[model samples]
Target: MGVHYVEGDLTPEAAAKVERLGYTAVWIAGTREPRLTIVERVLAATGALAVATGIVNIWYAEAQAVADTYHRLEAAYPGRFLLGIGAGHRELGTDFRSPYQALVDYLDVLDESGVPKQRRVLAALGPRVLKLAAERSAGAHPFLVTPEYTRRARELVGPDALLAVRLEVVHCGVEAASPNRAPARRH
Candidate 1:
């Protein structure tokens, strides 16, 4: 099975360990991280596993820069890198409008920059975006979704497209049966 880590959370050595322990891919979560170099470090350390960005938020970043990075990584590591793009949620009052159109325009830039469609994925939650992802890019990368959502996404994207889900695991050290544990609250 594959695992995920937020950008800058896993060091290169730790990533190497993850690969050694038989994880297939490393999905990097978070948007527009300042330390894009960390991804390169992880790529350098691992042998053959795929390293994918869970998403790079279009609203917070320029497409050209992202395309440049994609090219550079592809040149260095071949098929090891996959670029995932998304229209992220934010409180940018005026800047966040028309997310669907923004995503389309961003893809235009990536196209002109020659970042192949197969090398990229899209973070889609709804039918329209999922359809766009399948038609224009490699596949869909959905976050925090259920099995039913996966089923729907597959149907929307068709059988040929890829699907990468962001899975965040929270670990609490306190035992469930322990008195120290907080009581469960019900609605």
Candidate 2:
């Protein structure tokens, strides 16, 4: 399991605490990381725990720069970092006219910059991107997903793909795991 934190909320103590809690990985969710300092800090703060960006928005960050940081971090921390890239919500910018295409081009740049396919992941909120994530990268990372949605994602990605889901715990009169809980839809 992994713990998701906002980039700014991260501190060395918080990171160590997560590792102490037995979470194998940490994620900086919804942050536009044109640089990788946060990933490095998380790595520096923990032992035997992986760090991932979930994800760095393709609209704001340059792929080549992202790859450069990825290479540098890997050189220092090795396999403990996973670069999760995605085209964030189209409503965030006018440049997102073709999000899927933009993501493809960004991946091409990362490929040229030597960020290996296995070291990266993609945010998948829908089927097209989910399939692409499974085909071109290591796997799909979908947030706020239900079991039914995850099962369907598995079917779409096939057997050998990674499906790293981001979820939340509610403390109310919880019905989150109800069989009738509606499948979430995010695109």
Q: Global lDDT of each model?
A: 0.84, 0.86
lDDT digits (tens) for residues 1-187 of candidate 2:
8889888888878999999999999988867767777788889988889998999988888888898899999999989999999988655666835788998998899889989999999999889999999988999999888888999999998899888988655443567575433432222
Error of 2 at 181 (Å): 15
Best by TM-score: 2
TM for every model, in the order presented, reads 0.86, 0.87
Off by over 4 Å in 1: 33-35, 92-94, 167-187
Residue 90, candidate 1: alpha-carbon lDDT: 52
Q: How far is candidate 2 from the true structure (C-alpha RMSD, Å)?
A: 4.4
The per-residue C-alpha lDDT of model 1 at residue 179 equals: 47
- As a whole number from 0 to 100, the lDDT of residue 126 in candidate 2 is 89
